[model samples]
Target: MTNKVLNALANNSALLKWIVFLLAAFGFVWSMQLFIAGNAYYSVKNSIEVWQLSPDKASTQKVNSALDKIDNALNYFPNNALFYQIQGQLFEWKAITEANTKNTDSPTTDLTNKVFNLQEAAKSYEKSLKLRPNWSGSWIGLASVKRQQGELDDEFYSYLESANRAGPQDAILHKFIVDFGLQVFSARSFHYVKIKERLKHHLNLGIENPLSRDFVLKTIQKHNANEAVCRWLRDASYPVKKRIPNCITYN
Candidate 1:
């Protein structure tokens, strides 16, 4: 019985060695594949970053170059929100450049091109928001492009409201809403009520957040006489109003 066992072990030793060798080879191949894939992903991502940080204007050649980089990266990470956001930003930049183009040779043609660029930018931002609905930055980007195109009506204000909701703590978004309200609506317009509400909300937040406090104060200092600020001051607690010299003047 012992001799039979020894014979069986000897017969299967070569087969066991082959099995181990195949497993090691398979592991090496799999590891190499992962390493190659990771390196490609990072290289494309870095190229996208380089194009984004570049100071070059959004000329046709530069836009194409940046889009190409983003496309390559998307091939590897198709659902990446940042890539889509960057693409939207590039389109927005292109729109601004087009709007600023002074084609003395063909003014009508330049206007047509500018409109087309803004449309493209809006489309890009819509696509990005579809992928990432809660992205306040994309909303702001879209709102900015639309505002530049003179499309800031009721629907435009809705976008700003959505941006505020999506990024309540974003100081920049707060500032943008304040600026947009002041620029687009007359202080006496009912629409300015939205701006007042936004200010009050931020002021309440300012009790605990230093950034919010500073931003609120800065906005008040800049637009103290605006109806929204005066109304907010009037409606605020007496103590709060007393502390603000501008509010006293409004009274």
Candidate 2:
């Protein structure tokens, strides 16, 4: 049998060579995929583990240590948007903790540190967004950090606008922007009105599902917004035009 196999391969040398080439190509492609997936997994694992350590901002040393670990991970996975996002979140969390601590037992020096942390958080979120422009969560995180940092600049609003544009169909994303706008912008301001209208457009585009309408109304009312604006429900021409009693009035 071995002699017969050798004789066949010797006769079909071209076929044997083609078979070897195919096998090598398949192995190379499989190895490349595994390498990419392995790197992604390692980056994500490091990110999760850093947060798992439960760094406390009140203990500056602990927060700093966790940050150092994250930085080290970034050295290997610089493009891992998730890690950058987590770094942004950790910095923001530290800022909140620092603010709360300042209210009770913090020293004057802590105020400077709190500001620095917020600034760093903003930069981190921006970096994450640049790496993953279509990530709605990263946009929202940037918006939140900017808001916390008292940034009412064009950049702050752009982050939110980009988020809504990136996920117009995402009901939760619309609600978040609306809720945040209501809290920060005056009801009569152009920014607030634009955000409300954009959210209304999203709902309308969603076929005006009754559930989304109800959710939006509830969220608006939660922010002490006038129930009358629920008028957008009927105005948007949703299929379910049934007026909500307390929420929607004929007047």
Candidate 3:
């Protein structure tokens, strides 16, 4: 009886030891997984912080260095569309800096450089559009470059229309289209009444309202107009005959 009791006690001790060993193994595995997950989370967070800081760096040298780091990160994550879009925007800023230096008054002398920089901007914007086709700002930039080149008016208008369709809430596009109409009207040669009539037709103005009145006022202000037209437009109550009669009559 004493031998049987001792055997039973020994068996219980071994069984408890095995249970403890299994529990310890499970705890070790859980701790390791937690450590690995925490490290990965921190690493991804740091990488995103670096990318966010790249564009905000003040100095051009610092910005370029940060951008290089971002570029490497982007390469590692090629599927990230936002990174490509940001790269394209940086290229646009560089191109604008280059183009603004070209003097428009000497178009013949600066034509090559001007066109080259503008084309670079257009390319960057095109790439951005490819990454984000629904982005209206890219289309607007494309249209602006075409307008600057004085070519592709139809195409430019089409792009502008598309931009409007994509982002109808954006009032700036409507303003741009209106300004373009004003520029075209300003370039034409017509008497005040005829000019006003043409603007009303083209701009869809029903009468001599505030916008149409302002358009005529701006036209007189821009051109070397006779004093008569200027005075009348400036103060509509002024008698027309009190000043010079026509644009051709001005010195």
Candidate 2 clashes between residue pairs 3 or more apart in a chain or in different chains: none
Question: Candidate 3: where are CA atoms >4 Å away?
Answer: 1-109, 189-251
lDDT of 1 by residue, 163-242 (tens): 87888787546555655565434456666665666656555444235544444455555666345555655666665554
| Candidate 2: tens digits of C-alpha lDDT, residues 200-238 | 565354335442455555555566655444566666442
**lDDT-better candidate, 2 vs 3:** 2
Show the colliding residue pairs in model 3: none
For 117-221, candidate 3 gives per-residue lDDT tens digits of 567657656776777787666776677678677764568767876876776444334333434544564566332232343333322221133423333334434
Worst 10 residues of 1 by lDDT: 48-57
lDDT of every model, 2 decimals: 0.63, 0.64, 0.51
TM-score of each: 0.55, 0.54, 0.40
Error of 1 at 185 (Å): 6.4
Q: What RMSD does model 1 have?
A: 7.9
Give the number of the best model, judged by lDDT: 2
Candidate 1: regions farther than 4 A off: 1-69, 185-193, 199-251
